[model samples]
Target chain A: MKSMASTSDKILDIAQSLIVAGGYNGFSYADIADAIGIRKASIHHHFPAKAELVAVLVDRYTKQAAAGLQSLREQAASPADQLQLYIDYWRSCIENASQPFCVCAMLASEMQMLPDEVALRVRTHFRNLAAWLTSVLRAGVEQGLFRLDKRPDEQAQMLMASVHGAMLSARALGDPGLFMAIVAPEIARLRDT
Target chain B: MKSMASTSDKILDIAQSLIVAGGYNGFSYADIADAIGIRKASIHHHFPAKAELVAVLVDRYTKQAAAGLQSLREQAASPADQLQLYIDYWRSCIENASQPFCVCAMLASEMQMLPDEVALRVRTHFRNLAAWLTSVLRAGVEQGLFRLDKRPDEQAQMLMASVHGAMLSARALGDPGLFMAIVAPEIARLRDT
Candidate 1:
């Protein structure tokens, strides 16, 4: 049972990296088989289909992200710190070349081409992220840690788009520094406001 | 000569939509042929290879965008108006579902999977765009139409990321209004500052 779980975990890991590097349609089961040194049939035994594989991967990713955000809420003393920590987390990821781009963001780019299940999961991830961001911004506004020209919901969505857009820009330009260059000002603007 | 040019144009148009719908690896000659009522052999004759085809498409898209931006510069009276026009252009695109997304922005999502020729063009599109944005912001600053916390270039990158990122968020959440919701505030902040 443990071995079976490990194989599934390995498949999900590879799928995520593949999805991040390219997109939903970018990689295939053959690519995963090659990376994992397993036969195509073994992967089928676990995932059964590509859409199902990615759907599961997105579900897991969404849960992981939700937990991370929840922990952020606990660990960060203020809403401003929460926002800073969130940006710093992605900053380090891009700088280190580890999980550089958000898998959901990459998948979102190919939203029209994704399977219904996979697409649905991607939407859920964004929805969840937006909600968490809204909460933080709302908290920040309530506590006087942040100022916004828009309502908290609107501000949260704007910040979310800026972060994801920065990721795409950094990846598109092949310059990791581009991420911070694009995002730091956004955080600074919020503080100055 | 005219007929051949039209066929090539049709092929490029179909390929653009397909790439926007999916990614670099999302479609093929067969898909284009099926869409255009032509043979795969014919698409091959026109494009020769997918990389060359998309590379050519990005080039055309860059030219078209540059022309549009140039027109915006001439038509709008000020940098603030230029920025407003830019946002309005994308706003209508999303609202009408005509040219709903930027082709280069979509290709940027699949950058790692793209061929060298195609990837190079995508990067060029971004650099050219960044330059145009920077110029607009610089003009705005000089004219006292806008205030920015960062340098013009940095603020330009931030705005570009926000626009592109808002597109992603709108598409991911299946809400087109989300585009304006996310971007209007960014623009408003610039003006308010």
Candidate 2:
């Protein structure tokens, strides 16, 4: 049972990286096989179909992200601090060449081609992230820590888009600093006095 | 020669849609052939390889976008109006399902998988866009039509990221209005008194 769990985790990790690098159709079972030195049949035992595998991967990613966001809420005392920490986490990831892009964001780029199962999970991620962002912005407004030109939900959506867009720009430009350069102003504008 | 131009245009049109739907690895020569009802050999005759095909497509897309922005500059009297028209153009695209998404933005999602030729063009598109946006923002600031918390170039990057990010959000959520909802605030903040 222990070995099975590790294998499943390993498979998901590799799938996450592969999906981030090239998107939904970018990698295949054979690619995973070569990377892990496992046979195609093993991957099938775990995932059955490519769509099923990706759907499971997205499901796992969404849960992990939600947990991380929950942890952020618990750890940060202020909504502004929470937002800053969230940006810092992604900044470090991009700077270190580790988990540089959001898997769901990458998957979202291929939304039109994703299986319905996979697509639903991707949508859920955006919705959840937006909700988290909305709550944070609302809290910030209530505490007088941030100023908003739009409603909390609207600000959340804008912030969400900017963060994801910053990721895309950083990757495309091959400049990790570009991420902060783009996103810093987003956080700054919220607290602009 | 005229028919040849139309055939090439048709191929680019289909390739753009396919890339927007998926990513770099999403479609193939056979898919293009099937869509255009032409032999794969003919596609090869026009674009030898997928990398070359996409490189040409990005190049063409960049030129068209540049032309459109130039036209926006000519038609709109001020920086704010130019920015508004730019946003409106994308808003209409998302709403009407005409252009739908930026092809370069979509290809950027698969940057790692993209060949150097195609990747180079994608980078060029972004740089050109950032330059155009920077000039507009600078002009707006000088004209007192816009206020900035960051340098014009940085602000351009932020706006560019927000716009692209909004497109991803809109598509993922299957709500075109989400584009404006996310981007409108980015614009609104600049004009905030």
* TM-scores of chain A in all candidate models: 0.95, 0.96
lDDT of each: 0.91, 0.91
Q: Which stretches of candidate 2 lie over 4 Å from their true place?
A: A1-5, B1-5
Candidate 2: the clashing residue pairs are none
- Give per-residue lDDT, candidate 2, residue B132: 94
* Error of model 1, residue B47, in angstroms: 1.0
lDDT of 2 at A32: 88
- After TM-score superposition, the amount by which residue A56's alpha carbon in candidate 1 deviates from its true location, in angstroms, is 0.4
Give the range of the ten consecutive residues with the poorest summed lDDT in model 1 chain B: B184-193
TM-score of 2: 0.96
Model 1 Cα interface RMS deviation (Å): 0.8
